[model samples]
Target: MPVGEWDAVLVGGGVMSATLAVLLAEVRPDWRIAVLERLDDAGQESSAGWNNAGTGHAGLCEFNYTPQRPDGTVDPAGAVRVAEQFAASLVFWGRLVERGVLGPPEAFVRSVPHVGLGQGTDGVAYLRARFEALRGHPLFADLEFSDDPGVLASWLPLVLAGRTDGEPVAATRAAQGTDVDYGVLTRRLLAALRERGGEVRLRTEVTSLRRRDGRWELAVRDRASGGRRRLRARWVFVGAGGGTLPLLQSARVPEVRRYGGFPISGRFLRTERPELVAAHRAKAYGSAAPGAPPISVPHLDLRVVDGRESLLFGPFAAFSPRFLTRGRRSDLARSVRLGNLPVLLASARDNRSLIAHLVRQVTAPPSTRMAALRRFVPTARDEDWTLVAAGQRVQVLKETGGRGTLVGFGTEVVTSAGGSLAGLLGASPGASTAVAAMLDVLAACFPAQADEWRPRLAGLVPPPTPEEVARARRVLGLAPVRPAVAP
Candidate 1:
């Protein structure tokens, strides 16, 4: 083999890249690796805790993960997969904390109850079915559900405020859920990787990628020093969050053909009242109203940052020309490649519902948003909360049968058959399941090394199987069966 510049080059400094770098370093300690980040520091983008809901998306409180069919049947597959992935991440993060790689575990992750709240008879039925379907899953053994208003009140009293004195409601909760500060985790993991002699080049941007003699040649620019450089790597991973699409197009990999991104920006309402904040102790998620987009499903989350308990709600999705919140205005226009035109067209044709939802969102005034908020907290006063910009999520769009098709959720990993380059596309149930997602990337990109890497991964992720779920329940002291149906 002719001398390659490095063993691997990671394209971003977010959770995905940092996690991959750590995995590669642990397995191939002698290999040279470099991380190129466009920003001045790591974890400043969507992975930042403040930029996201930080729910640790376990399918625990998120009802959108388990949608009901037209025939009234519910599929628990999506919920189970998300729950299993989050379980694996907790085990992995725990091991890293034990190894001193992530110092002061509280800085990055904290345990908090996850609750799902809903109203009326129809909503109660959905919650009951969702609860039943998930209660038996090995990964969801700790779930609890109740229809009593008293039980619902205990979970979140404000949810029932100013309601008809006899109105009925329902709630389901799980103690195993968490709120993860992914940015903090990213910084800590990257610190350990650096300690192991791995190089992370901040403020370095990749201008282009080309295959030269079966190796990846990346043209890089040092953002701070105005210096240009070239790096040749045996493999390249593009973990650029929303920037991945553009980079993949530059590679002309063909696997990314007919793909386009639809940008959705989220906003939240936060309360500063200490008294109200103290009353709220868990993340309470609710079902989206009829015809509401899945991304617009409202939730009231209790967020603890820097040891302060603050309440956050909403994540109302709006249209944006920029792929990232900090991205350039040219993002949407520049990503339209010849190969992706069909995908773009197909997406618009298939997602009339999402388009209508976006229209209502954009044309609606601030008062409209306040009205939506009132559904979750009837007593919630507009004067008590302020609107805060959440983050930008670039949903994936692709061509299907000569038309563009829009997918609201699920993540796609696109890499050429050669496995020299790969990029992650889409969002949702993100950040919370970084470990499993990265593991899938490694499994796809490196098949031959998987058997050897499995043990190392298992040590970090505990048991990634049903059998381990039992052991985890015992060791973690979690309930074995939905915790006696909550009151």
Candidate 2:
């Protein structure tokens, strides 16, 4: 029996679902909206502050976003697109703060410089090329670059400390970059949704989803009460992070027939030592090792969670058959279907280097992990940091040109059932791009409402102009932007 019907049902309590719920409420206030989460509380998974690096990924510090071309020039297109997307998120959040929908901006977001570090001769050259390529863009006009050790010392004292090697080094700094506590933001979005008459059901897991009579029927179970019920919705969105793949498979979505998932877990070295945290005031990203996945790019971040500061480093790969931290060990095996088996096998065959990289990371001892960290922080001590498990990211694998291809760090949104059903897959630059990604979902799934909703959506998340970006930064308590130094 169907207990309730809704205009939209979002299957997750993370940032993505919460964002979509809030957006829908703003656009179609008369439509009933509901969000279902399996966890006891919201934002406990990948959106959690501790589970991620907490960098507001605007393509500022992450070197992987800008790869070198054959001619030695850097590609700035990917980074520019990411910067624009993150600007939308900032604008939406700033509007919420201005309207009293969210509390103080400082509670969830803070200004933190983003720095891209490049070591060795080749690294230095690439860093300079990247800076030159991006400096002309409005979003990165304030970027600063330097190869002098003295200037670098002032910018990154902790990273420069105790470094005796004279190897060439370079860095680029963007002051507009920020560190965001997405978990706090997610919870706040959900809270605002409730205030707008949206329903949020926690501790309730959707067992399955089926299409019936122009609506999606979701079989839900109350984890605490052992009771089950059915609900109906005109549209259903699966934003369950790593758990999304299985749910889409269960729905028998044709778009997912040629898709598979490869689970990749990560561990970080975190420290709450006040001195160390204070010394490193920026999120610094370094290039990934040869033959490693882009997600393997090493980064050191200054994280502020719940008004407390700390430092995090080394997202060393960890192996787990489970798709999610709380998911079953059988998740990987259960997701392998006849339609996706070939894709999975091909992905594994083609990504042997990635598999080997994971193997090295999983079996590497403490000293090995420490050595990796020392590359970023020359004086880092093992005693000051402890290994902590990060979230599980399910990399999406799909058949492209008759061969399996592993999607990189970018997020992928899959829509099916004539745009009535949709799910989010992949990770990295995930939460930072929530607003833009959710907007795409709305456009893709609600084509009939596109023209009607265009005006309302525009008001909510307008195209980011230079003035709008400046205003959003000011509203978010960020400092004014500075002009870029001439190359």
Which one is best on TM-score?
2
Q: What residue pairs clash in candidate 1, if any at all?
A: 343-399, 345-404, 346-403, 346-404, 346-405, 347-404, 347-405
Give candidate 2's TM-score: 0.98
Q: What is the lDDT of residue 365 in candidate 2?
A: 95
lDDT of 1 at 438: 83
What lDDT, from 0 to 1, does candidate 2 have?
0.91
Shift of residue 84 alpha carbon in model 1, Å: 0.4
Note the Cα lDDT for every prediction shown. 0.81, 0.91
In angstroms, the error of model 2 at 483 is: 1.4
TM-score of each: 0.94, 0.98
lDDT of 1: 0.81
- Superposition error at 324 for model 2 (Å): 1.4
